[model samples]
Target: MYGRILKVYPGSLAEELELVPGDKLLEINGTRLRDIIDVSFAFADEEIEMLVEHEDGQQEVYEFDKDYDEELGVE
Candidate 1:
């Protein structure tokens, strides 16, 4: 399962990674994301590997080693 990025906040990690509103979140740390609830558990990791699909059908991978408490700033 995958979750589409409906919104990316300004100055957010997603925005910093150049993610757009239409980006689809395919995976996190190699695990498929099935629902919103999974986000809390998955994002708790200080290191994250996110696979994103853009509206133009382009795919990009992002690696994050941020503070565990840092917000993703997305919905």
Candidate 2:
């Protein structure tokens, strides 16, 4: 199971990672996501390891080192 990305805000971390709508978010920091609530909790960390499945069916992992208060800007 995965969370589908709907939008990536410009000038945000999602955009910086090149994520787009239709991308499937699989996990954050190795924890599987079951709902939006999980996403919220998982995103609180300064270090993130995200696994995403692109529209092309290719899966990739993205790592980010950010401010503890930074947002990813995806909906």
Candidate 3:
């Protein structure tokens, strides 16, 4: 999925993770992300590993643990 982030909400988990608008969300725990719904479902787990591809073509991995119903805090 071309799961590009369009925006990052203030004080959100995404922001906490330093995710920015235009950052492409590549995967979650090695599973490719296809869309927002996919993101939501993947985030259901308390333990998450996000693969983010930046606009500069650099890839980064972010892992964190949160509640099952935790919000991404994005807009």
TM-score of each: 0.90, 0.95, 0.91
lDDT per residue as tens, model 1, 1-75: 788878889999878887877789888888888898787778889999988888898888999798989878777
Question: Candidate 2's residue-wise lDDT over 1-75, tens digit each?
Answer: 779999999999999999999999999999999999888899999999999999999999999898888988899
Give the candidate order by descending TM-score.
Answer: 2, 3, 1
Clashing pairs in 2: none
- Model 1 lDDT-worst window of ten: 14-23
lDDT of each: 0.84, 0.93, 0.86
Residues 1-75, candidate 3, lDDT per residue (tens digit)? Answer: 758788898888999999998898889877898788888888898999989899999999999999878898765
Residue pairs with backbone overlap in model 3 = none
Residue pair clashes in candidate 1 = none
Scored by TM-score, the top model is 2
Which candidate has the highest lDDT of all? 2
